[model samples]
Target chain A: MAQLTLVQALNEALRHELREDPRTLVFGEDVGRLGGVFRVTDGLQEEFGERRVFDTPLAESAIVGSAIGLALAGWRPVCEIQFDGFSYPALDQVITNLAKYRGRTRGRAALPVTIRIPSGGGIGGPEHHGESPETYYAHTAGLKVVAPSGPAEGYQLLRAAIRDPDPVIFLEPKSRYWTKEEVDAAAAGRLGQARIVREGTHATLIAWGAMTARCLQAAEAAAEDGVELEVVDCRSLVPLDVDTLSASVRKTGRAVVVHEAPLTAGFGAEISARLMETIFRDLKAPVLRVTGYDIPYPAAAVEAAYLPDLDRILTAVQKVLDY
Target chain B: MPSLRPDQLKELYRLMAFTRRVDQEAVALQRQGELTAFPPLTGQEAAQVGSAYALQRQDFAFPSYREMGVAIVRGVDLVEYLRAYRGDWNGGLYDLYAHNFGPIASSVGSHALHAVGWAMGAALDGGGKAAIVYFGEGATSEGDVHEAMNFAGIFRAPVVFFVQNNQWAISVPVARQTAAPIHRKAEAYGFPGLRIDGNDVLAVHAATAEALERARAGGGPTLIEALTYRLGAHSTADDPTRYRQAAEVEPWRAQDPLLRLAAQIDDEDFTRQVVEEVEERVRDLRTRLLSAPRAEPEEMFEFVYAEPPATLAAQREELRQWHS
Candidate 1:
């Protein structure tokens, strides 16, 4: 076991995958030499040479669409979309082609490509910099959406996404890039399954990417309030852990969903609706949700208010408890 | 390129007729309120069938919604195609093997990237399989198409981009789509590009076959713009008379590839027999299509992912409850 930051874990995974498989290639804006803005891809270009880890002409569409072609050619490409907001320009390729290619081609081709988007807010940045656009890819039928809360899950899931037979939209929480965790080497391939980071029988707080950390923080804070909170790291969002979630919600009879995406039409609504349908009879209260407001992710100064933090999550838990 | 055989010529004529008849059926069904929206490809039959016919069985296709004519030739069940237009399923029920056809892109120019990617895969795997992607001239304006072509060119991926320049994109005309000729744009990307008479099925077949052969031989990508015209309203929901002049449409009607093939064959007896058989097929397909039980609403939740998240399962049940 080794203690590593999320960025370090991600870099380790890329290095391991590239070393293990000759087909793996990494490319994106400033991903080479500069090791990417977040440094998730640091040292890769130096070790692998330009062909394997090269800088692309700042075209998000080309980076993604070309990765699709590269993947089809039997290369496992891990593409960096730089930031959550920068991913929109490539939405055409992500949603329309990358998502649908496997089913459309009837497994004749497998797009074993991983698109890494440094997502979520908290860093003082401009508009479009800190946004949660996973819902768009999650809503899309063909793509698998995954967000790792910390270092270990990030390493495991990034490798899993690269090896999986489908296209994966891997969203990394920008806020936790430097946050450290002890990664068990034994837990690398155990992806696609939700992890019970903290177990409790009172209520389940489910979140992914950046929000999962806040949920954990809220769980710690709620402990002082005499509330036992179960926290789940939703490692994979699209192929979600319904069995784990439903069972947890059934046990607790309450749930609070959290994410950095806007409230309306965000993935939280989908989760809330799902819990209500399956465990409505088991519920002591309606499933409460603490989410980003329904507006374009604002500028950095007010981004804290725009995102669901520990207080908001605690409030949601308290409301569900009172019910 | 393979020399055009008599049988091939005859098949091309028959496919054009079939495409026209199918589009005609869709339009009628829409008029009678049996269908929701019908996007007609009346004048574009030659380009679709001729180019599709030229493809080898192993070659793949990526289609925009208007390429139903090619879908028919590629073995997409006609009724399934209709079901989609009728707002039944996200697409007709055909998996990859049933017809190497892709799902219809309701969004314009989006699937172009899929074609480029697939071609790239074929090249990378040393499969020697080529792919052809079909879209409208309007698609040229889409960034995805541009990206797809650029990628294909740089990688030397074995793909032929077939654009059916049907002269209008919904209400937008071809001239407004781009200042330069659409095919010539391929030159700037470092590939050979051609503009052919789309109404000439022979020309389309010849051009596509050459491109496909070149691609298979590692000659890289080619772009063929079949300059055609749209003879009908964009879809059941459209009214073309508002934007296009009747005079402009009159000339293209005379140049109908369907009519030209029918006339050149001079086999009224063969034409009648084939048309009768096609009509029977369409009638049976319509019965099976309409009577085919509506997909279990739950199935909508089923292939959203190979396995959907708990949230999707929850939403499915929620919808079920709301419906109940």
Candidate 2:
């Protein structure tokens, strides 16, 4: 077991993959010498050589678009989006073409592209630097969306995503970049396998990426009130471990969905709807949700308040239980 | 450089005739409500065919929606070609990797980036092969094209950026696309740029061949701007009469690529035989596509993911239930 931060774990995974597969490449603006803004690709270019890991012009569309082309040309390319909020410039490439090309080719092509985005808020950055745009990728079919809230997940999922035979949007929680955990590089949890952090019969608390740690904290606080809260880390948002989610919700009979993205039309709505359809009759109450506001992510002053903390999560948990 | 051989010129003419016939058939089908829409590449056959002919089977190609000429020259099946026009799927039927040709850029200028990326990959793989990407003057205005050109320039990727300045981007004329010629735009990307007579098939062929050769020889990308005219409506749904006069159209007809190549193949019997053969092939392709069963709406779900997520599968089921 290696004790590493989320960023270090990501760097390790990238280095491992680049060394393991000669076809795997790492490229983005500042990824070569600068080691990425978050240093997730630290030392990759130096070890892998310039051709295997290089830097590109500061163009998001080109970075992602070329990665797709590289994949088509038999190269497994992992492109870093720099930040979550900066990912929109490549939305058309990610959505209109790259996401649909494999299907358009009718399974004749496999675009094994992995796009790395340092996502989520609470780091006290500007609007463009901090945001949760995983919904956009999750909404776009053909692309698998995954987010890792811890160092272990950060390492394993990055490797797994690089090996995936399709395009993957790997959202790393920037807030958790400094969070240290022991990561066993060889032990990889499956892509869509949601991890159950705590076993509780009172209510199930489901969250992912940056919000999973917050959900755990909320669960810890709730334990003082005799409320045994169960926490689940939804590692992969696209495939979505519905079976795990359902089994947890079925046991607890109440659920509180949490995320950093906005409330309306967020991925939470899908989870809520799916829970309703699958475990409606078994539930003690309706699936309650605690999420960010529908407006743009606010400034640093009120960001902590804006993000769902222990109080907010407990509020939703209480509502579900009272119902 | 040596002059064009008789065989090469004849091959170019054969492809040009085939593309022109395909355009005519597509237009006729559109008129008969057989297709959703058709983007006719009438007067610009030389630009697409000649340039595409320059590419080897190993060289990658990225084409805009108006490159039926390129597709035909690349050995794409006619039925599969028309299948896309019928709104069945993305254009053409071939192993995109094996054939080294991408699906037509559904969005105009975005494919330039893809070509640059592919070329960069090709260069990294240590191949003598190069890549070619086609678009129109209107596409040059798009930011993605500029970014792609920038990347290609900086990385020194082996790619040929082929722009067919067909005088208009729908209703917007060439004047609106840019003040200077589109080829000169490549100069900003720190690469060589050339303007060629797009209506002249021989000229288009020579320029593309030279540029591709330079690329394969470790030279960076080249931008070749082929100046031509769209002698028909922008698409089947478009009305050229709404914006332009017949006087503008008449002058381009005089510069038609097919008629210019006529003098090269002056034998009446050869022209007659080739024209008849291409027309017969076009008819057969259209008949096969029309006779084929229409694509099912639910079939769209199949390719949406490598393994369809339960969410999408359930949604597909919901849509089915809602319909019935």
Candidate 3:
């Protein structure tokens, strides 16, 4: 085990996939010599040569759309869509084309496309740089959505996404890119399995992507107020760790879903509704949700208020515990 | 003009005749309520058939909605092909890969990206296997088409962007579609562009063959704007008299691709045989479509995924129980 940053672990995962399969390719805007805008693909072009790891023109639709074609041609393409908000330009390809391929071909063809998006707002970036778009993808039928909270999951999830027979939207939490953690680079975690980061009894705090770390901090903060909380890192959003989440809620009898996106129609709502439906009888309180307000992703100055934080998560926990 | 051999010329005539017959039969079927709707390729048959005929057996082609002619020429199973228009399947035909064809995309200009992408993959395999994507003049307005050409040009992907400028995108005419010549737009994407008389089967074949060759040789993508006219309503559901004048279309009668071929070839018996064959094929399609068992409700769940996800399976059960 070694302590590597999230980007380093992702790089290692990509490096492993490239070395293992010649059909695997890495391409996006500034991915080659520039090593990507975020440098997640740093030294990839040098390490694997230009043919396998290369830069593409600044066209997200073509990047995502062509990967679909490449998959049909028996090649595994890992396309990077630069940033979260920028991925909107390619959403047409994602929603209309990528999601329809399997259904269109009637199970005859499988598109093994891994679309990597660096998302969430914490480091204070421009308008289009930081946005949480996981819900939009998770709602899509043919796509499997996963977000890593730390370096280890980053390494494991990206690798697994590459090997899956279906399309996977690997949402990389940009805030956690530098958060160093011990990682077994070889460990390819199964998709849709939740990891209970910390176990408690009074309440369950569930979060994914950038909010997972904050949720853990909130659990610690809640302990000071005589409240013990279970922190579940929801790694996979689409196939969802519903079983683990329901079990945790069944144990604690109180659950709070946290996310950086808006409150209404957020992925948190889906989780809360599921918990209410399946394990409502076990709940000591109504499932509470701590989420960003419904507003346009504000500029860098007011971005903090726009995203869910530790205090917000703790407040939701206290509210659920009081019930 | 690149001259066609005796057999090649005869084959070209046969494909056009077959396409024409199929167009007539499908329109007739739509009229008789056997089919829901169909986009007739009456005047644009040569544009579809010639370009599709140019591809190598392994080379892939992506077609827009009106490419029934291309599908017919490729020998895609007619019964399975009609299942799509029969409202049984969302995608047109089955076993697209076996015929070296992509699904007939309904969305405008979308399949261009798929074509360019498949072409890139074929190029990587390094065998001279090229790809062709067919779209209408209206589709050029879509951003994905521009991006598709851009990608194909930059990567030197082996693809032919065949634009059948068939005068109208439903009610909107070519004049409203673009300000400049359609073919010249390829220059912006750094590729060679050509405009051909799409109604002329020989010219369409020659231009398409040349582009496919250059693509196979790794010369990058080429844009071919086949200037043809749509002789019928956009679909059986459309009424064209509202937007266009009958007088305006009267002149294209002499320019019909099939009529031009009939003037070149003097084999009356061959034409009669081809008409007979097409009639037989249409009859066979009708019989199969009628006899085929309706897709079971459970069949929807089976093909959704290689191994169905938990939610999907659960939902399928919900549907099955609800139906029961």
Candidate 4:
């Protein structure tokens, strides 16, 4: 095991899958020679050859739309959508076809298609660069949505997603791509299990994707104040490990849902409602949410203010603890 | 005549006549409140059957909701194919892989991308097989169709873009759908496009067979726009009298695909034999459809995913509990 960044680990996982499965294909805009804009797919085309790993035309819908067909044709296509906001152009294909194909065909077809979208803000790039579009995917019925916090989770979850028979929307946190962690390549894991990153009893800070790191930071800060916080990294959002989430919330008797997407109708709402439904009697206080404002993901300059940081998470944690 | 033998011409006549009769029966079924709705291929029989007939055993066909003739040609179970109109299933109940046909796509023009993608896969697998996608003239207006064509061109994917220009997308006319002819759109994608008389079974079959051959030979994609008229209402739910004139319908009646094929064959005994065979098959289809069992409620949750998640499982269990 070596210390590798999330992007590097993802590359390793992709390489492993490519070596293992001849039917697996990796393609997207700039994913071939350019190695992706974030360099996550660096050296893949050179290693796998253009047939297994190649570049596609700059059409998001076609990338996903063709991936669906490729999947139907018995190829496991792992496609990328360039960025989070760019996924909207392919939403029709994703929501209408990819998500419904299996149900449409009545289990006759299994689309092992993994759509990778570099998600969340923190790089302070221009508009449409750093939006969190996970909620749209999570709400979709026939899709499995997952987000990794760091290197190890990134590598393992991506591998699992590729192996999964159903379609998976793998949201890679752009902000956390450069963060390094030692990833065990042989480590085995499943898709719907949540990992408790930190153990505590004062309160549980539930989050996924980039916000999980922020929650860990908040937990660290809250510990200084003599209030130990538990942090749960919800790896898979769709087939939610409600047992893990409820167990953590039940132990703490308090919960704070966190995400970077807007507060209204976000995935946090679903988590908050689930917690309320499952562990209502075990709660010490009402579950609070720390999320981005309902407004559009603002200009890059003001993005830091829009995104939920340590201060916002800690404050929400403090409110739940105080109650 | 050069491409098709006399026997093959007789077979084409039989298939077109079969499709025309089945289509008429389906419309009647809808009128009798058996089927929820059906988009009749009343005028586009030759275009659907001829192109579908040209597909080799290894080749696949992606069809829109209206291509029941394609389904018939592809040898899909007629009872199973009618399940979608019966509102008994999402798509039809046919085995897609076995028949080498995809599910009926109600979302117009979306399956074009799937066809191209499948063709790309076939090409990548280094096979001689090709994929054919059927849509109407109006489907050209969709962005996915344009993207499918563009991708097919760039990748040299083995696909046939078969557009049955049946003149109407519901109430919208061909003129409203595009400025130029539908086949000319292929020129921009760096491929040859053919415009043929959709009512002529022999012409439709030859064009599709040639296009399929080119595709299988790695000649990239071809677009064939078969010009015809929507001789009836778009669907059982639609009314042609509201949008079109009777005068316009009168001329297309003379150019009916089945009538044209029958005139070409010109054998009264042959036509009677084809009609008898079609009637027997339709009778069997009606019996099977009427007798088909209603799907279990729990089955609704089964096919959504290969491994249904815990939440979906729980919901399924809850449905069972409610029933119990």
Which one is best on lDDT?
A: 4
Candidate 4, what DockQ?
0.86
Q: What is the lDDT of residue A311 in candidate 3?
A: 73
Model 2 Cα lDDT, one tens digit per residue, A175-203:
99999999998886567788898888899
Prediction 2: B-chain TM-score:
0.96
DockQ, all candidates in order: 0.35, 0.71, 0.72, 0.86
Which pairs clash inside model 4? Answer: none
Q: Comparing 3 and 4 by TM-score, which wins?
A: 4
Q: Which candidate, 1 or 2, would have the higher DockQ against the true structure?
A: 2
What docking grade does candidate 2 earn?
A: medium
- Fnat, model by model in order, equals 0.41, 0.70, 0.60, 0.77
Considering only N, C-alpha and C atoms within 3 Å, which residue pairs clash in candidate 3? Answer: none
Model 3's DockQ score: 0.72
lDDT of 4 by residue, A264-288 (tens): 9999899999999999999999999
Ranking by DockQ: 4, 3, 2, 1
Candidate 2: where are CA atoms >4 Å away? B315-324
| Model 1 lDDT at residue B11 | 84
Mind sharing the TM-score for model 4?
Answer: 0.99
Per-residue lDDT for B115 in model 4? 97
- Pick by TM-score: which candidate is best? 4
> For residues A234-271, what per-residue lDDT tens digits would candidate 1 score against the true structure?
78877877777888889988899998888888888887
The TM-score each candidate achieves on chain A is: 0.97, 0.99, 0.98, 0.99
Considering lDDT, where higher is better, how would the candidates rank from best to worst? 4, 2, 3, 1
lDDT of candidate 4 at residue B108, scale 0 to 100: 94
